[model samples]
Structure formats: C-alpha cells, structure tokens
Target: MVSFTELNQQNDTITELSNVLCHLIDERSVCDLKVTCDLFFSYVDQVKEHLDLEERELYQSMLLHSDQNIRNTANKFLSGSGEIKRVFGQYLKRWSKNKELRINDHDQFVKDTREMFQLVFNRIEDEVEHLYPTVRAVQAAMPK
Candidate 1:
C-alpha cells in the first residue's frame, strides 16, 4: 500500500500544477505561452496516468475484490468523477486552441478554465479523501 505521505505529496504537486495552469491562462503571456502549454500538457498526461492506475488497479480491485457495500459506494463516487472527466476534456480542447483564440474569446475561455480547475480540484480532493482511506483500510485487511 502507498503511504499517506506519498499521497499527500502527490496532492500538493497536483495543486501546484493546477495553480500554475490557472495563472498561465489568466496572464496570457504570448511569449512563454507555447512553453507553458507544452509543460501543462505533459503534466496533465502524467496526472492522468497516475489516475488511470488508481481507477483501473486500485478502484477495480476494491470494487471486485472487496465488500459489496464498498463497491456500491465507489460506483456512486465514480459517477461524479465521470462528469468531471468530461469537463476536463472540454477544458483541454480549449487550452489546445488557446493560441488561435481571438481576444473576445479569451474572457470566456478563462472563465471556463477556472471553473474546470475548480471541478478538477474538488474531484481530486474528494477522491483522495474518500478513496485512499478506504484503500488503506482494505490493504490492512489483506495478508502479505
């Protein structure tokens, strides 16, 4: 099982990344925009990879190999996450074409982007708060 400290560290890293993304969009620095976009995309990919392992491996194991109640709860949580994931895809599309966007489009994009960040932050916090504790509990029960 992963340690709580490790999970907390990951949470902090993600928060920092999200903050930087928000700052980039708000500042709209044409100079470093390309570099920022590349970095943001790389960070997003890494974060998604980490989440995939959690959802597919950890969540799957919990749902299939654990109690029915836990599975049911996890499913409920997953429904909310699915909505957030859809929003995230939209947010990514907006960011990818950000350079091509007109000045008039910038305000709306920034607004939407901020909302996206909030959604992501809330979803991640919820998952880490709820899912990790359950994962730790289940891990404790299993024999090495």
Candidate 2:
C-alpha cells in the first residue's frame, strides 16, 4: 500500500505540472507551441497513470470496505473520476497530434486548456480537502 504522504506528493507534482502545461499553451511561436504540446501530452499521460494507480490501490480497497459509507463515497468518487478521465481523454485526442495548436485555433485551445485546468484543480481540491482525509480515517480505523 502506498503511504498517504507519497500519494499527496504525487498529487502536488501533478498540480505543478498542470500549471506548467496551462502556462505553456500561451507561447506564441510555432516551434515553442509544438514543444509545449508535447509537454502537455506528457502531462496528460502522467495524469492517466496516476488515476490508474489510485483506482487500483485506493478506490478498489475502498469499494470493498466493510463500512457502507466508505464504500458509497468511494463509488461516488470513482464515478466522478470517470467523467474527468473522459474529458482528459477527449482533450488528448484533440490536441496530441502533430497539428500545432497555436496555428490551428489559439483561442479555442486556450479556452479548452483553461477549462481542463479548472476541472482538474477542483478535483484535486476535493481529494485533498475531503476524500483523502476520509480515506485516512477509514484506514486508521481498520484492524491491523
């Protein structure tokens, strides 16, 4: 099982990377934009991997938890996370190609990127403020 500290560290890293990717989208040069797009794709990949890990290690356990409330909350989180994954997956398919975003449609690209950033930011805040603490309490109450 991964420690809470480690999970939180990973979350912090993802948030930082997200901020960088959002800022990178504003670069005006075509070459810089291409580079930024590559970085953005990489960040998306990282988020996918992180979600996979959380589902496997955290959500799965919570879903099977003896406590009914814990199980229900885990189910809710999983359902909500699926929507987030879908949004990111669609964004990746739209923006991950060789087409330069800056040259393609800069305003739409910025708008979409900002929307994703806000979604992810809210998701992270929920996890940190609510889900993580609840999960920790559940874990602490578990028999060792």
Candidate 3:
C-alpha cells in the first residue's frame, strides 16, 4: 500500500498541474501555443495516471473490507471515478485531437476547462475529507 504522504503529494501535484493549465488558458483566449497544448495534454495524462494509482493502491482494498461503511465509501468513490473518467473523455474528444487542441470556441473552451479543473479539485477535496480518514482508520485497526 502507498503511504498517505505519497497519496497527498500526488493530489498536490495534480492540483498544481491543473492550476498551471488554468493560468495558461486564462492568460490567452487563443489555444495556439505549442507549449500550452503540450502542457494541456500532459495534464490530462497525469491526472488519469494519478487516478489509476489511487484506485489500485487505496480504494480497491476498501471495497472488500469487512466493514460496511468502508465498502460503501469505496463504492461511492468508484462510481464517482467512473463519472469523472467518462466526462474527461468527452472533454478531450471535444477539444483535442491527435495530441492537439482545436478550440473553435475559445470562450466556451475556457469555461469548460475551468469546470473540468473544478471537478478535479472537488474530487481531491472529497478524497482528503472522506476517503483518507477512513483508509487511515482501517490501517490503524489492522495488525501492523
């Protein structure tokens, strides 16, 4: 299992990357910079990777734990994870293609991008407030 510190760090990094992305978008209505597009693609990949690790190293065990509350929490997270993944996929399809972003509607793109980042931020906050405590309690109760 990964330590809570590492998990927290991953969340921080994810948040930082999203913030950078938000800034890049906010500074310019045009999404024509190669660097900006690169970072945007990279941000999506990093977020997906972090989520994969989080699910594997943290949530899976909780799903099968002896406690009902833990199982319920895990189920909720899993459901949320699916929804996030689905929405992100749709967003990518709309804005990006072949490693490039074609933002035909700049204003709408900015709005959607911010909304996506907000969703990511909300998920991280939710994990910190609910998921981590439950996982820590489960680990503490286990025979170390």
Clashes of each: 0, 0, 0
- Tens digit of per-residue lDDT, candidate 1, span 1-76: 4566765676677778878777777775541456766756655665665565566656666777659877875786
After superposition, candidate 1 runs with Cα above 4 Å error: 1-7, 30-32, 97-104
- Per-candidate local distance difference test: 0.67, 0.76, 0.87
Summarize candidate 3's per-residue lDDT along 23-43 as a digit string, tens digits.
788766447789899888888
Give candidate 1's error at residue 57 in angstroms: 2.2
Candidate 3 regions off by >4 Å? none
> Whole-model lDDT, candidate 1?
0.67
lDDT of 2 at 72: 86
What is every candidate's alpha-carbon RMSD to the true fold?
3.1, 2.3, 1.4
Best TM-score among the predictions, by candidate number: 3
* Pairs with backbone N, CA or C atoms under 3 Å apart (clashes), candidate 3: none
lDDT of 2 by residue, 76-101 (tens): 87887899999987886775555344
TM-score of each: 0.77, 0.86, 0.93
Sort by lDDT, best first: what order? Answer: 3, 2, 1
**lDDT of candidate model 2 versus the reference:** 0.76
Taking all chains together, the TM-score of candidate 2 against the true structure is 0.86
Give the distance in Å from residue 77's predicted Cα in candidate 2 to where it truly belongs: 1.1
User: How far does residue 91 in candidate 2 sit from its true spot (Å)?
Assistant: 1.4
